[model samples]
Target: MQRDKAYVIKHYKKSLDWINNLRGLSEEQWRTPIAPGKWSVAEVIGHLPPWDMFVLNHRIPFLLTDERLPKGPDVAHLNTMAAKKSREQAMEETLNDFISTRRQLLQTIQQWTNEQWQHSFKIGQSEMTIIDYFVGLINHDLHHFSQIQNVIHV
Candidate 1:
């Protein structure tokens, strides 16, 4: 699926607003699991900033270049750590972390040229455009957001 840079940027910006608004949720609600045997809303949101940082620090620099990309994060380990931190920290801390990292990501995205958006790059064995990469991330955000919404009705 083709994704416009503007659309992706919009989603990034909207995500900040969405998470910011979640400040109003009760502490219990913030900690509520999306489903049985699943992550709480805080865990889900907390996991996102590291991935954004990964994209900003690792993926973005190497994309559209001949350099071999660095290894991706260990997802399970990272998620586990983020979840543990989320469970231990205040809701405000989690929300602030999400907003800060997402804002950094959005700022980086705003500076990309059209060529950067559409040019194909090899990420490991898979080749895709910057837009394509972001579309996948956006879908991920949507999925987690839906889960959060379902549990909290916010």
Candidate 2:
């Protein structure tokens, strides 16, 4: 199997598992602040859309066709900018959008050829193999999920 695809698919399953586990949450719980000076659960979930759109659509194709990365829209500040919209959204809508968007992203990833798994990309000024990029995304999910869980029943 392609190494990057295998690793990313594995973790995407885990990400789905994590989201499924949250099926019991109350709306209030989903809206609870997940981190200090950071996103609420809904906002963090909302953040997935653009990243998935970027990676599965733009980055992979761009790297394969021209070997270039997105050069603008400071990613470090992205969550902050996006969280503003989340704050105005209904929790259920945001969660549904996250699940729907991620499912589409996983589907796109599954279509990639073996060479695409080795595609080089840059995320926030860091260089990475496609495998590393997917791993990092999985790790990012875990990190934020932990924050959500910590705030869930408290």
Candidate 3:
């Protein structure tokens, strides 16, 4: 909630810890939908890695510079593919992907200078500080984490 680098890093690490500990979930539970017509738990978790990779590869490099940030991903298409893969793959694989990618993201965040964290940059028509950008992402993670918690009753 502080929206500082420390806070953002904490939640990112927390999310990884939460996912790593989910090995206890039954396969049926992993495959169960969070709600009717919504993504299954696995799908929800599976979608995270690509977004993390996007931040690592796309957003971070441009956020402190004047360069135009790359266009955001096609959400529907990416989620569709992620969901399909989640439904097809084992839960361990999905969780491992998340862990690996998220760890990379965390490492990158940890290396940022304070100015990099506080610097403002444009994304399309809008501008926000790098810390603010990460706060938004942390909120996104919280929303999905909450959805999964409700579905799995964990």
Candidate 4:
């Protein structure tokens, strides 16, 4: 993939449209579970913001620095924490946080130089570019969106 600004912006725009589809869902719909052991639509939606915040605060900054990047955060643990926090929040509030944090991340990304987008962040013995990192996040959003759609339609 090219992994350019336009590509990243496309994903960001698509995310907003996808999220808009969740608006106005009934309280019951929002609370619907994906499967027997899975998180509800609300909790899945709530899980996204902090990861974006992490991208903005920790991942991106560490990558921008010339210093060696540390190991990635424990995503499973973060998700567990985020899901628990979301479980107590209203659907509207969680959705709003998702929208706000995503937009903020997008805005921050929009200002980056091409070099920054192409900059490689070391992970273990390998490296991944900033744009690649964002693509992973986009996939993460889509994964949750699909989960929400499946549960909502059931």
Best by TM-score: 3
lDDT of 1 at 142: 99
Q: Candidate order by TM-score, highest to lowest? A: 3, 1, 4, 2
Stretches of model 1 off by over 4 angstroms after superposition: none
| Model 2 worst lDDT run, 10 consecutive residues | 64-73
- Encode model 3's per-residue lDDT on 1-154: one tens digit a residue: 3678889889988988999878999999998899999889999999989889989999888887888889988999988998889889999999999999999999989999877899998877788899989998988999999999998988
For 1-154, candidate 4 gives per-residue lDDT tens digits of 6757788888887787777778879988888888888788888888889988887887777877778765667989999998998899887788889889989988888889888888877767767888787777777777877777777763
lDDT of 3 at 24: 96
lDDT of each: 0.90, 0.73, 0.90, 0.81
Q: After superposition, how far is residue 54 of candidate 1 from its true place, in Å?
A: 1.0
Clashes of each: 0, 0, 0, 0
The TM-scores, one per candidate, come to 0.96, 0.80, 0.97, 0.89
* lDDT at position 115, candidate 1: 76
Candidate 1, residue 33: Cα displacement in angstroms equals 0.6
Residue pairs that clash (backbone atoms under 3 angstroms), model 2: none
The model with the greater lDDT, 1 or 2, is: 1
- Summing lDDT over every window of 10 consecutive residues in candidate 1, give the lowest-scoring window: 1-10
